[model samples]
Target: MARAPKDHKTNALRELDAAGIVHEALFFDADPAMTGVQIAQSQGEDVDAVFKTLVTEGKSGEHYVFLVPVACELDLKKASAAAGEKSVAMVRARDLLPLTGYVHGGCSPIGMKKRFATFVDETAQLFDEIYFSGGKVGCQVRMAPDDLALLVPFAYADLTA
Candidate 1:
């Protein structure tokens, strides 16, 4: 099937294009209740190739972002160490919109309201390209890990357990 021209551009997708990073947006049906795992599974995508964006607040009130593979859990201990904080906690769902300009099911590390310290799971290094929410629930953007790092200002670490 032929893919349609990119019309419904999200901030995330626009940022990618502005940075000169090539990416493809794949559309799928997802619910607010669906996790990254569920989205990948329902879309017949390889779980290892899909990532979830999570936001956390450090003890110093600094916000941090992590992109981990869909099938894994973010290791809080590892996350804290990566962020140079003694502890970190997920940002409240209610705060996500105000903080990142995104809702619970559609947060993307790219084009956030403010630049948060961002990190990607070391496993992302294993894939040339990975899929993450295109700042929306149904649009998945697939791009090279290197490209993502360049556009999002991120580091790679052992973020998942």
Candidate 2:
């Protein structure tokens, strides 16, 4: 029932609201150098329940999104397999903001400039709720994975290395 502060509504939060997805918005003191693990630690959340959003490009030039546990790395082979691409590569950092309307550490799977094929690490299903970036640094959203599916269509897969 923790809602975002009215003064700090992010695109992701707004999208969730429009979709009627229940969520809690968590804010913390954050530094640009902070990693996703550090952010989750600051929130006192288990690393397994917190995910980081990653963007990749397929050989066909299509973009895809993947949500992996903050403590894990995305296995490119698995990612490519899930994406049905022969290969996939991380999108260049410089292109993130323009392409997804999000910066590297602040990307969320919820709201992007455009919708792409999105996948979540199957481990996310192990939690009743999961935490992910709320569209910007210092903001995170806690919600049921099923609720998240209402906002973004995604499949669960073994995405970790």
Candidate 3:
């Protein structure tokens, strides 16, 4: 029921609206002090149902987006293999803003300036619904995994343990 503040607009949210994607936005204490796992716990949601967006660079110097459950870690090897790349490394926090047009902790896979090779952890299919950042800290959007997959350009792969 919580919606983003009127003054704070993000490209991700705008894209969702433009696409007619139905999503519920929720807000928690804007505590930059907590991690994604901590926020999920405080919200009384299963940690596994919460996902975090990660940006990685392939050996080819291409950026890729990885969405994995908060409960699991992104296996760079699996991700690279899925993308048919040699290897992958995390993008530095400082670099994320310019690359994705989103700040760290608020980078959603939606509304990127340009679509990169995106990968969704196959484990995400296990959940009926999942929560992801609404392109801003303290704000989250819940939607069906299938819906997300449909809206975002991504491939499903076993990128997690």
Candidate 1 wrongly placed segments (more than 4 Å): 1-7
TM-score of each: 0.93, 0.95, 0.93
Expressed as tens digits, the lDDT of each residue in 23-138 for candidate 2 is 98887767898888877787679989999999999999999999999999999999999999999999999999999999988899988999999999999999999999999877
Error of 2 at 37 (Å): 1.2
Alpha-carbon lDDT, every model: 0.87, 0.91, 0.85
Task: Judging by lDDT against the true structure, name the best candidate.
Answer: 2
lDDT of 1 by residue, 74-135 (tens): 99999999999999999999999999998887898988999999999998889888998888
Task: Report the candidate with higher lDDT, 1 versus 2.
Answer: 2
Error of 3 at 35 (Å): 1.3
Clashes of each: 0, 0, 0
Q: RMSD (Cα, Å) of candidate 2?
A: 2.0
